[model samples]
Target chain A: MRTAEALRMAVEALRVNRLRSMLTMLGVIIGVLSVVILVAIGTGAKNAVEKEIAGLGSNIILVVPGQVGLGAAPTQSRLDLSDVAYVRRVVGDPSKVTVAVNSGEPVRVGRVEVFATLTGTDENMPHVFDRPLRRGRYLTGTDVDTRRRVVILGSEVAAKLFGDVDPIGRQVTIAGVRFRVIGVYETVGSTFGVARDQEVHLPVTTAQRLIGLPRINGIAVGASGPDEIEPLRQRVVAALAARYPDETFSAVTQTQLLGTIGTVLGMLTGVLAAIAGISLLVGGVGVSNIMLVSVRERTKEIGLRKALGARGRDILGQFLIEAVLLTTIGGVIGILTGVGGALLIQAVSPVPASITWWSIVLAFGVSAAVGVFFGVAPARRAARLDPVVALRTD
Target chain B: MSHDERAGRRDDERAEASAEPGAAGAPAFEAIGLTRSYRLDGGVQVDALRGADLRIGQGEFAAIVGPSGSGKSTLMHLLGCLDRPTSGTLLVNGVDVATLDDARLADLRNRTIGFVFQSFHLLPRTSALDNVALPLVYRGAPRAVRRERARAALEAVGLGHRLTHRPSQMSGGEQQRVAIARALVGDPRVLLADEPTGNLDSRNGEEVMGLLERLNEGGVAVVLVTHDADVAARARRQIRVRDGRIERDT
Candidate 1:
């Protein structure tokens, strides 16, 4: 029989049992939908992270003491203030380099106490980190040069310590030492669930003196351009290596951070998509089971068609086409629902979700392939049925 | 029948005659010592047909009558090429069944034979027109041509106006007529009816019998299987089967 004729016959057969056909296709629908939706959410999260990292500025390098990466063991900080000056000299721009020494401290403002991350840095904090002050003056060269007891409050920290009150001139006690707030930072949102808004910054010299720690945690440097970032990172690493030849340092550019993050996120998305594909496989099995039942129910019809001169291959083509039609239709419906669900998530929630065209195409292709893979057994069974026995069935 | 119906039947016969190879002297079917057997699940073998010889000619109306389990249906199946005999030479339309593969045998069945079953075997949810067009679908006929042929065939069985009626919506007699129309739509030389009127009331049975007789008069050979003696008496030839053998042929 011609393929078109077989298709028409299959359409007729499926239409005869419309409810059963729809129910059979539900498994594939759910499978494809979950696959598309999950992959979309994963891809969206990956894109969001990439955007967030990019937002931090590209022409920068982050240098942390000790080797920090996969499989690296924790080590004590050997970095000191001299390393910062060395890096400054290496970069040839002292204004573009800064160092941060961080400690968690409880701050008291008229008995309104809150725990906040206290990071101490030089006067070039805003220039190096690209932070803008909302009020008052940022730390000047004189503050760090003289170890002045002055602090800059993050937006959240300002709100907590002095709610509705102008906090620029307010005095807050940190680590049992009183410091006047000289600046309030404009709000910078959280990255990777770590809030930047709840931090208070002071001059590194005053923080070292107040906390009794003379060592810094990490260094931040702003490169003049994207092209200088990599070479500048290597120079800083070499300079630090020269200062502490026995200790290791990690100098990482923003692009390297983004690439590592992208690879991990890509693998995570693929794994999630694969896990969702199992349900699709189960759905294909459902299709096969339903096809078997349909074949059994239509045994007499098979006999009649055979008697009417339908060849074995003709019967096979008929049932196989029917199965494929069932799944392809389900796949189309799934793609629509998955796209809608992803967009709905994007609209209503903070959990990022965006559909990818490849996921849609892949879901569709797998659903159809599921049909072909699972359809063969039942179709072959129908083809191999003896007409005499089938016709004998009531 | 009207004069026009007679002329149309004669035209069909002439078309079939010209299309057939060796048409002048070929018997519709010739079976010699045809035997068939079935193996039970526990390795018991039972003979369904034991060396039955039969010859049916063109334009002849015949009945094979036997009690249940006497293998009359088996004989009908073999004659219709729906089953192969275990150890006999069977010829359908002058071609030996033994020489043809499954596909060629199916093609031969398509071109030369039609079947009407006891249950009327019309697709329950399909329109009469589509059910009749099914055979031509296998024949690879174009849609328009299949529809036109199906319409003509249904009209021949006096059902042209009921083309769109499904089998469930039709009476038993009408469904059987639809089956007959489907059988004839392919323009086969032989029509095989297995208890064609068995499911209908006596009035409807008589109507179906009259219809089959009229179709036979149109130069198509007709073979029927029945247990009813009165039905068998109407045929031009009667073959009695018992113990998987033809006990009498007259």
Candidate 2:
């Protein structure tokens, strides 16, 4: 039989029972939708993390005083301000790295008190974190050497403490000591539940003097290139170990941080995909069951076609194509719904969701595979039917 | 019931059998020692056709008559290529049917034979034209050709204007005519009808019989299987079977 004829017959057969066919397709739609949406969510998070890490200079590394643990933040610093000179001089190629130290405290500006992470660094701070000043000037190297009592408020902190009023050249009290705000840093939006725009940058010498601490919480370093990041990190680690003795400090590069985050995201996507796959499996079974019933019901029609010269292969192809058509259409609907759902979530919520070309292709291919896999039994049964007995069936 | 009336009817049937239109050809199918057996549910073996022998020629109107369980239906199935024989030398258009594989047999059915079932067997929820066009579809004809040939066949059956009528909407006589049209659409060498009028009234039954007679006159060999003596009498030649064997052929 011609393929076109067989397809027409299969379409007619399906059309005769449209309601049943649609109900059967529902299973497949849900399966595809979940897979698309869940994969999108996973991809979205991965992209978001990558973008953030990239923004913070993927070549950057942080040397802090604590062992790394899940969700663990380091509490105190035992390495002092004098160690900074050792890190710059002892570390390989000082021209390839930019180093800064940071710590935070609540400070009062006028009558408003803003909770902020105070970053104490010299001129390289803006380049290290890519936070260029929006107003006034960044601190000069001379300011750090002179221990100038000047600060740069983060965009959000400036907004809260000064409202619409100018904060530059104004004094803010930190631990009963006043520092002049010479500039405000550019706005960095909130991401991953943390707001980078709320911090205040200051000269390292001034911050140390105000806090009455010669030690600093952490040191952040940016390398000139990706090739330099790892080597720069190793030098920082070596320099810290020599000074701190018992390995009191730990250094983590952005690449290593991204690696950890990627692993977690990969596992998360896999789990979500498996959960979605279960629904797809159930949908395939539903298709199989319905096809079996359809074959049984059309036994006489099969006989008539056989007697009219339809070979077993014709019968098999017809049923198989019918099954495939049902699942493929369901897959198409799923792809649309899943992509739409991901975009919808992204639009309404802070959650990041992404849809990829591979996901659509994968979903469609799986649905077709499901059709062929599940259609085999019923199609075989149809092909193997005896025309005489089939015709004799009422 | 009179002997004279019976003698006159026999003579008339003999004349009709010889006078059948376009009857000058080799047999469409010839069966020699054809046999079929059934393995019952309890493993009890029963023979449906026991070395049955008969010959049906082209453009001839022949009827096979038998009581229930007499195996005339089994012979029809074997002749129609719906079933393989248990054992026999059955030739369809000079090719041994038993030697043909399933695909070859199916091809033979599609090209050389057409069938009309008792229930009409017209697919439900379809236009009459589509029902007639189905056999040609299996033949893999182009869609336009299929529709054109189907339309002509329906016209030949005097259903030219009822092209869109579905089986459920047509009368029993009309449905049977549509089946006949379907059978004729393939332009097969032989047409087979099994109890073609089993569900119709006497008037409709005769109308269907008349249509079959006309198709036979138009050079399509037709074979009718029936239990009704009146239905059987319409055929030019009658073959009677009993207990899985041919009792008489005339």
Candidate 3:
């Protein structure tokens, strides 16, 4: 028989039994939906993590004084000014290094006093940490050298202390000392629910003098570029080893931490994706079972066709086409459902879910393959039926 | 009718036909020493046809009649290329049945023979028009041409108005008419019908038999298998089977 006519007949057969066709296709729909939604979630989470890592300077490194004991609670490490100076000298480029010192201090703007993190650093601190100044200037080299009590208010702190008014040229008191706000930093949005732009900055010597601390808590350094981070980290480790001969300090690069987090997230996504893939297998088996039943139910019809001169290949083609059409339609519906479901989840929940083009293509391709793989046995059975015997049957 | 008288009459006619010179352009179905057997469950063999020799010409309206289990249906199946006779040389359209392969046999069945069953064997869910068009589809006719031919066949069978009606929606006589249209659609050389009127009322049965007679008059060979003596009387030639062998032929 002509393929077009066979296809029309197959379509008509399916249409005549609407409920049965829909129920059969449901398996494929769920399979494709699960795959698309899970993959979307995985892609979205990976993108979020990459963005967070990029927010921190790609070439930045953190130096913590004294290695903490295994399984111990995190405690502040102490580093002297001599350790920072030694890193700068060993790096051979004063322009590339910025040593930051941070401490918790009570600060006030007019009558509003709040506990704010006080970061004390040199002029290069802004560039090293990728911190952009929104309004006024950052702490200058002259300010650091003269021990001027100047401050840079973070975006949130400026919003809270001054309301709609500009914070530049305003004065804030920290640890009983008043300082002029040189700049109000621009807002950097939250990462993992933590607001980044919510602190105040000061000159390194001023913070130390105000807090009455002989040593700094830690130092933050930046390499020239991403490629130079590891080499620069090694240089800093050697320099710190020489300077603090009696105490041990640990240097952690952002790349190392980002790599570890990325590995863990990837593994988690892979496991979840595998679990979701199980639904596809169930869907394929469902298709196979339905096809087997269809073959049995249509046995007389098949026998009659054979008597009317339909070739075995014709019978095989008709059944196989029916199977493929069912799954393909289901696949399309499933894709729409999965993408819509992901978008709905994103709208209603805090978790990020993103659907990619490749995921859509992959889901469709796999569903088509499942149809063919499951359709083979039933089609072959229909083809191999004996016309003489079939015609003799009722 | 005594079995001896029937057997003696068949032998005398067979001898007279064999004694005459072959007629030019004789009809195709000619059998010599035709025999067929089936093995029962206990390995006892039963002969369904034994030394049954007969000749049917082209464009002949012939009927084979017998009581139930007389092997008339089996003979019809063999004549229609649906089955092969064992240990017999049966020639159809000048081609020896034993010489053809299975695929060739199927091809012959499609091209040379069309069948009408007692139950009307029309696909249940399909419209009469589509059911009629099925044989043409197997013959690889293009869609438009097949539809046109099927419509013409249905019109010939006086069912043109009911082309879109499915078997379930049609009366028994209408369904048989549709089956006849299906058989006619392929323009086969022979129309073989096994008890085509067995399921219908007398009026509908007469209508179906008249339709077959008209088709035969149109120069297509017709072969009928029936138990009704009145139905057998309508054919120009009649063959009666007793047990597994042809008892009389006239």
All candidates: TM-score:
0.92, 0.86, 0.76
Pairing residues by index, what is the TM-score of model 1? 0.92
TM-score of candidate 2 relative to the true fold: 0.86
Q: For model 2, what fraction of the real interface contacts is kept?
A: 0.76
Chain B structural similarity (TM-score) per candidate = 0.91, 0.88, 0.88
Tens digits of per-residue lDDT, candidate 3, A1-394, equal: 6677777977987797789889888998998899889988887887777677678665888777766334545555567677677777887776667776777777787788777778788887876787788999988999888999899988988887888998889888887778998998888765545456667888888877887775777777778777888887888887888776886777777777667667777777777666666787688788888888888888877877766667778788888888887788889999999999999988998778888898889889888888888888898898777665566777
What would the per-residue lDDT of candidate 2 be over residues B214-235, giving only the tens digit for each residue?
8889888889899999999999
What does DockQ give for each predicted structure? Answer: 0.66, 0.58, 0.33
- Per-residue error at A393 for model 3, in Å? 4.1
Candidate 3 ranges with C-alpha deviation above 4 Å: A57-84, A99-123, A133-185, A190-273, B1-57, B69-71, B74-106, B239-250
- Which residue segments of model 2 deviate by more than 4 Å? A64-78, A90-115, A136-151, A160-166, A169-182, A190-193, A203-217, A230-260, B1-26, B39-46
Could you give the CAPRI-style class of model 3? acceptable
The model with the greater lDDT, 1 or 2, is 1
Descending-DockQ candidate ranking: 1, 2, 3
Per prediction, fnat is 0.64, 0.76, 0.38
- The CAPRI classification for model 2 reads as medium
lDDT of each: 0.89, 0.85, 0.81
Model 2, C-alpha of A328: deviation from truth (Å): 1.2
Worst 10 residues of 2 chain B by lDDT: B17-26
Task: Specify the poorest-scoring 10-residue window by lDDT in model 3 chain B.
Answer: B17-26
Interface C-alpha root-mean-square deviation, candidates in order: 0.7, 0.9, 1.9
